[model samples]
Target: MNHGSQPEPPLDTPFGDWLRWALVRNGYDPEERGVQRRFADASGIPVATVSRLLRDKGQPDVGTCYALGVTLGIPVMPLLVRAGHLPPEALEKEPQPTERPRTPTTEEEALTALGVIDETDRAAVKSVINALTAKHRQEGTS
Candidate 1:
């Protein structure tokens, strides 16, 4: 519970170790002054909870892991697995394929994909595309 400027002890558990490494990798120094409070504020976690996690005193719940992952710009599955909430096998599960938006195949499609609804804007875009295509063709023939 010492919140002084002294460097905190190294985390001992696997999750805690990983969290510390993640923090450092994301440009946070756990041992720096007010780092716990900063991390708690950034992750929307309580200061006590963050401190306890840093000390390897308790496991983080799913919400906590999600918040930490968002704040750390890292994936949440690893956090959950490391916190012992999910089995290591969970990491091996194949991710479901997300449906990707279809690519625009024409100038009109590109303008629509960009949500350009104004007729004037569409005309301008077409003009630019035409100019680029003409330039490319001229260059190819050179």
Candidate 2:
């Protein structure tokens, strides 16, 4: 029996669209990423069958992923990553932590001297500390 052209029912409807959107964003031109056609021709599975499979959802379980990979000339692991079932390895890079500004001894000294003049000096010291920290952050970012 011919499986109609309608998309397969999925556990999460948005997931399909989200996957499709990611595929497109990742430079898989719809024209070139003809996964169904590619799978069908390579696997000897009918295009209609592949099309029906694409329509179904629920994270493209491992077996389904393997079937498509076998047909599409893609590795199954990467395909799962594309669908967000697997985290993309490219995203695993540790972002270099920015170094913050060193607390300025000069500012600390100035604040200490000011504290001697004003009995209520805690606020001024805190303000200086905050300023140094902010400067350090800004310098590291640049």
Candidate 3:
């Protein structure tokens, strides 16, 4: 596996259905969850769509698959590849770079070049930093 990529698994038959079951079962609660709520929360998919998928098994579509993967915190590539929806090599391909590595004139210039914001609305940046710092301080020296 690459630094950022996970190995695509070879899914057994009934993989897609099983995946949904696994995700929901892993987070399952006996009385606290309905299929719509669990499916939406687990897959980041719309609850209605989840219901539609459950109702119309072949109609869930890409959005449903993608949402389920995202919500489950598993990459879509692995699932698709495993399920024969995508070629295995597709998962290993790196995204095309839009530009070359930037070369700064000096070390300090390079460090300074890495800015969190650039003409973007950053009103809450300080607040987030402060909150993070407080959290870190609370955690102490690990």
Candidate 4:
């Protein structure tokens, strides 16, 4: 993941920022050489499209956002919201009178339920989860 000497320029748009963060979270350094092509191949998006997105040169379609999310193991809703294809309110849950709300059973589910859509926040939460899981495993072994 060595990106060499050139630093990555700041992503001006929210979607661009999120895409860059998600790429890093998924172990793809945006600054690394051939990252755009690699990510495009992984996500099944065209290399040119991926390049434009990585460079923050154009807007992405909903399908592109969903494809990237799937490739990154992130929920597509957040991507859609960040890409402006959907409003922030789209992520809010509506009450269902017939069914009771179920608690989140996994880290991803918990993050989604808590609306922790920011990639930075998601990474922090994942780090804490990993630390806690490791500590618990150690304690159990002891």
Per lDDT, the best of the predicted structures is 1
Question: Residue-wise lDDT of candidate 3 within 1-142, one digit each (tens)?
Answer: 1112323324543554545454444464323458567657655777676655544344445665576567767677666665556776886673657656667885345445666353342435556656888998899942
Candidate 4 lands at a TM-score of 0.56
TM-score for all models, in order of appearance: 0.58, 0.29, 0.41, 0.56
Give candidate 3's error at residue 20 in angstroms. 3.5
Compute the lDDT of residue 116 as modeled in candidate 3.
39
**lDDT score for residue 87 of model 2:** 69
Ranking by TM-score: 1, 4, 3, 2
Residues 1-142, candidate 4, lDDT per residue (tens digit)? 5333334333334566667777877788988899888998888999899778867787789899889878988777767767777777777853356667788998788999999989999999999988888998989952
Give the clashing pairs for model 3: 43-67
Comparing candidate 3 with candidate 4, which one achieves the higher TM-score? 4
Per-residue lDDT, model 2, residue 1, is 16
Worst 10 residues of 2 by lDDT: 1-10
Worst 10 residues of 3 by lDDT: 1-10
- Judged by TM-score, which candidate is best? 1
- How good is model 2 by TM-score? 0.29
Candidate 3 TM-score, C-alpha based: 0.41
Model 1: weakest 10-residue lDDT segment is 1-10
